[model samples]
Target: MCPEPSTSGVSPPVDAVTGIEAETDHENDAFSDYASDVSDTTSTTSSVRAYVYENGRRYHSYRPGQYLLPNDETEQDRLDMTHHVFSLTLNGDLCKTELDNPQSILDIGTGTGIWAMDIGDAYPSAEVIGTDLSPIQSEWVPPNVQFEVDDATLDWTFPENKFDFIHARTLAGAIQDWPDLVGKCYTHCKAGGQVEISEGRANFFCDDDTLDKSSKTWQWLAEFRKLSEPLGFDIAPRLPDILKAAGFEDVQLTQKHVPLGTWPKDPKLREIGRIFRVQFLEMAIEAYSLALFTRFGNWTSEEVQVLLAMVRTELKSNKIHLYTYTYLNDLKRKAESNDSNDHHSPEKRQNTLTSEAGNDDPGDEITNNLSQDSQFLAASTSGEETLPNLKNPLVSTPSKFLTDFQGRRRFLGPSSTWAYSRHVMGLIRKYLGQHQPLEIPLNTDGTAFALEFPSTKQPGTTITMQDLPSRDYAIYLINTVKFHVCQTYHLFEEQSFMQGFSKLYSEGPQPLNAENKLWYVQYFIVMAFGKALLMRGSSEVNPYGSEYISRAMELLPDVNGLYQDPITSVEICCGLSLYLQSVDHRNTAYVYVSEYLQFYRVLHELICCSLVSPFA
Candidate 1:
């Protein structure tokens, strides 16, 4: 229960939303106000003050394992550094909202109270409140800013429909229930209040040949995800859907790329990269690992340190253009909106986990620099699309590949396809002759023209089927993608593809032979897509097939003569592009699209020179 507000002699701070003069006393009871708002069950007691120390690091005493990161001096410094990095990424803005004067704001998981204090300073008239499990905020803060010891997972008790804006950053691992947290924010917010959530995932990526699929850095991050997912930590991909389920209207998601080192030629991005490297090497790696690896992974502190040391070395190298993906999901609550289903409906919540923060931008942001500024983009699922069921019988799937729900418009529904896919199919149809039907082959029988597989430049170092799904599972996945997902207007012909997959799966546990290298990547992507689309309710098709996608990507350049079968390259690119897009990997899909065009030009030249056959 909230302690009754005592009437004071001094003029009360005006309630910003209702324009009512609320009775209040701040001097004697500062923490309790923000504290009571977030946690109803927990009190302002000494138990929260209890601190735990392990592995030469510190963690919160209350709900000790709810959060993965430590709450210590080094961790404090990292928190502040993270705020600076986010500020830089957002071009010095405290947030993306345009509210000129927000009355009351809540910052969840406000480590060290840096963002709260900064936001308080930004809007001096507005009262700002920050909450965290640990009371580590600075003693001296702006008059309007207050630090509270509260847990977000608890029932919010301050008041319903109260705050003007709520902000939470990097809470991927802190809150166990993302939907529950957002639902609370939506409820406690005033009629038009807004919420912003910023989370970054360690999904490492590279455009060039520098970062390998087998790199330890990739392996280490993958390991962390594998372990942390059981605890419900991964965030970026599913946040948008979760927010919408909470009835947050006009939800928007933006993606920003942070390089591991100074690799970007753009001056602004280079600066971001330098600081980004410090963010990882200085404290992030250690702060991330000490608790996670030691406790859950059952590994000694020394082993974790040695692995981190090697990771640090790799991060420092300029050759590798390593980078990570960060996302911001911003939304607003409507005044008259009725609570849709139970904000925590189990079925709706289950559908959200597979949803990705899908970007509708065709690679323009990834390939170019708009003055090198990080831009906010509306997600593909941000708006609703409704179109009458198509009555035309002659309209083939290939003809509609380039369009969304409505062609050349922002009206993107389920039928929304990438521009690259449209162009690739158009070219394939043009060459094969408008009247001739397309035949997409799947077998590695080596019985057709442009079919003889080329030997690898270095066969010993070639990528083979080492880590993949079992034979039966692989067959099921291929069948799932049989009629579509071939390499040009690309798709897998059922019979031939089944024949190839049968032979490939016969190898049992042994690594695939050298002659099967091209077939290996093609088969790998087929299975990757198959499993990606076939998951009954898997949280992420991404993790299930990430290794498959990564290996096929590695084999793209240098290893296999992908140009031998131009349509094959198109098939890989188109299939992977769709699969990547499905997993909310829009930027990487864009790169594959660029690769699709690069090979399309090669195939165009081959046609002119009479060196290759189109339907071969």
Candidate 2:
């Protein structure tokens, strides 16, 4: 019933695998002996002249540099990485449609045309057409697959109801009007056909309390969103609504939490996190930011680079557990029939809409109770039903509480804090018992314990610690409490501790007083140790340590007048000692510490009326 694909004006399709191999060979042969051919390729052909070349990458000249990123080999690699990520997320399936034999498929905004080629190979009998703005797709492709240079936002010239399946993914930032795009897809898809939309949430989220509002990564995301607002591409949680509004039936939404780094305990998630860190964070962040920040936000390239560097540091840190939600929407077009349709009228359809939030797995049919004039109706059925709400027939009503795949909730129950404390205290006692024998008093939760041991600094003296939990126990308590409290809560704010500090240092300081001076001293102490923690387990020296220490030293004059107080003097000395111990400096650290002690003595004498206050 369908016409064969015409190869009249189009390039002949090459074997898909053979194309990939040829590209790989070209890269290896060209790059092995010399650098990549970064020379201008715009004049290679009249069609290639439509692209703008910059920084060894090609950009779309049709929009006059509207799209910030390049369509070069680097971007192609990142697109492949995204393909892997999507494949893993969907459990090796491209779409959730149950169609036995889809005749025609359309892929919108299909960069690199990899997905289309793969689908073409999988279904040799089907025709797959991949459309994009650039013509950077490989010359070789599957016989049934074809690539065309087309902007998805423009009016599509394809015949009505031509495709059996339509798919669009990762077009969040590229689309200006998503509702219009969905409508176009609905118009082109055949009756009883399916449309699948896949997109990741634009904002970042964290289940653990590790990532807070003040993090550098959060700031970067805030700035990115601000610049992206004018582009009209902020569609994540609202995707399902848009699909349903486009006259599609049987809309289903699935949400998954994708980690940003390799910090998850689960092996599968850990691998995904690693790929995201390397492919997205390290390689693609700059390409995504460079033009947007410069043109839209008026930020200098150097300033953007500095901000991105800080973001990279935060992303690499295991202490920050971050993830973003990826949403998949599956919808179907109604079959043509003579039966009266409930949602045929736009007015009634708009008025009778209902919203239902789903969990990770499929659940019940959310019903909307409305008047007789309302078009929305709830229908529950098995797999045979046209618009079945449940994904699996065996999945019944979901339990009120959320559970993991193993069906066990690994969270703190009632009295969990007490139990955790007891377990930690037991471990501390076992480790510390070998050092000395002493009476250790237990608090109500058995966390606070006191032990007398010879001080490492002052070997002969026995130091008694009271009302303090052991270091290991404290860590366990913090982790347990955070895991329980932050399981459901997600923080989304730009103003935070680090942002405040950045503003203070970048801008001139306010009128310094006693309180403000003490705050500066405390902040310096905290940051020095924070850097130490971030640089742990590294074989090489931490490149950030010297810069951080230098910045902290700039605040030294703020605390100059407080040298008369022994507690203030002791705090500064202790902070300096800890910082000296943290960094691995050959000679610069000793020089800095000696200069600090000399400055402290001079300030002490100035604060005191005479030099005989403490030194004399």
Candidate 3:
């Protein structure tokens, strides 16, 4: 019943970004050789029984070619991330409709069954069913929850007008015949059942209109929009009308701005955008394109990939303020109008995902639902903020999200310096057995109660010459770090870091200036991550990684040991911060992050102004 990730075709797409790969075959390696016989009696309980593969991805086989995206593990993870992003958009509430002791819950197009499982766990008494064309859900689900492989577009065998709640999302590109689908939803949902459908408009929008109409990002989207028209992917704008046409009453239309990256200024919105960045950059860009372009547009996989790479680069560019609108068309907005008095309290409609984990604290202000993910996320923002003043989103955004440290606000961290100092004094008092502590905000990723120790003391050890890897191995590690780490966090200046690497690894240990020494420390820190990624199979303390980090720590001790070169100092600080975050030194990593944000923000502002400034 389980569909495994491809055993091959895992080639990295570096050249894809450059759009220079030679053309070849079109068959996808993931499932090209795998095929299933047509059983006289096909079970609706599993999709692995039958499969269709294309362009290095998998898709639903019920109506094999209808849906444009894949149904593999990669797509499943993106779906979960999408769910988390939206949950955050609603401020911890799963839906706008307050589920009143829901007895029956139905999640349509339940990609990974994450939402269905969470709902099942929350409403123990409710009977929950998640239906999709793929039966990839885990075998172990809540007793009340179950999954079925049913084609939503075809006749659903589910009892009509029986569900108390029905929900669907991210079904933009997969859907065909929108009205019939809504009619079926209305037909199946109980008389007073609440239906929530969220479909983001299939096109991107720039409030500032800075995105050129002729840009690849726009051109590609316009191509997909026109191509997918016959397939009926443009479902967001017509969803409300569809619900109304289906005889659904009290339809409420709520819209959310789904930013494409870390472009929003609001603390929560910035966090949301950050997660979307990863979701789009790593996989969604290709996942959303490969099928539509090749199957419909008759473009070769290589050509589509080339165009997709250009789009990826454009999406990641800093010149645009782009976002898409996701509309929530709920069928029960009028359910609570009878009593204008608010009835849903935090205690009553508490979000269940974090409730059991004890993560929900109203006093904490911001809630990160993604769990060790990005926020700015549902857990990890890029770990290190390139912008120094991340905490001041409103102020920084109006000033074009200043990256410069010049004239930055004094208070930049989650908590102010005065508050941090108070915590320090409180820790000392507590150590002496006499202390009355004031309420302090734990803003550093909520990693610590107080900054007691910088981190566990390290041995005064150094990575000896004998411990260093060969030149080729070192280059491999650096490249691995670049693809895996640098692409995500943007750790350091490419040319400068490469130059440093060349100098340090040259025939002679270049005369050790302060700059050289600091670069040596930074290089070691970067190399540690290379070892960490490769050592995933083993959880034991990696002696080599430990040794590299220890030697770096021995040289620098704290974040950015030297400040002579502010840019290099910020780089050191970011590298250290990411390492600390990886090793569960989150609070310490946060401190490093807070410091670097100030330094990096200014540097970023200077670069952007230099590039785009009219006077320049």
- Clash counts for the predictions, in order: 5, 0, 18
Question: lDDT of each structure?
Answer: 0.60, 0.53, 0.58
Q: Which residue segments of model 2 deviate by more than 4 Å?
A: 1-45, 54-57, 212-214, 337-616
Q: Cα lDDT of model 3 overall?
A: 0.58
Please list all clashing residue pairs in model 1, or write none if there are none.
404-416, 486-490, 486-491, 487-570, 487-571
Which is the leading candidate under lDDT? 1
lDDT of 1 by residue, 1-616 (tens): 0111122211111110111111223323422222111174354477886789888888898877888888876677567657756866776567756553577999999988878876765455578989888877765455578878888998877688889999999987787777778767877888788888988764455545555545666556656766677666656666766676566777776666666665566555655666666667767889887788888898899999888987776666555566665676777888676656454354455555345324433222122121234342332222112112432122223111122232211211122234433444666788777855456432222222121113453445443445655443354355446423332345544554555665655544334454445566677777667644433112212234555766666555441566565555566677777766655465656777786787687667757534542344
Superposed model 3: Cα runs more than 4 Å off:
1-47, 333-616
Candidate 2 TM-score over all chains jointly: 0.49
Q: How many residue pairs of model 3 clash at the backbone?
A: 18
Write the residue-wise lDDT of candidate 2 on 1-616 in tens digits: 0111122211111100110001122222311211110001122245643678754456776545545677765576567567756665554455545555576999987877778876765455578988876666655455578877777777678887799999899887788667667767877888889888888766555544455566677678768878776775557666766676557778776665566665665555654565566666645787778777887898988888899998876665555556655677777888873423334333344453333322322233211211111111121222233222322111122212224455432312222122333454655667787544335443222121121112332212211222222222222222322343334322111133234344453453545454455444434444445332322212122322343344445444424455444344445555555454333331333554476677677766665534423223
What lDDT is obtained when candidate 2 is compared to the true structure? Answer: 0.53
Measured against the true structure, the TM-scores of the candidates, in listed sequence, are: 0.51, 0.49, 0.50
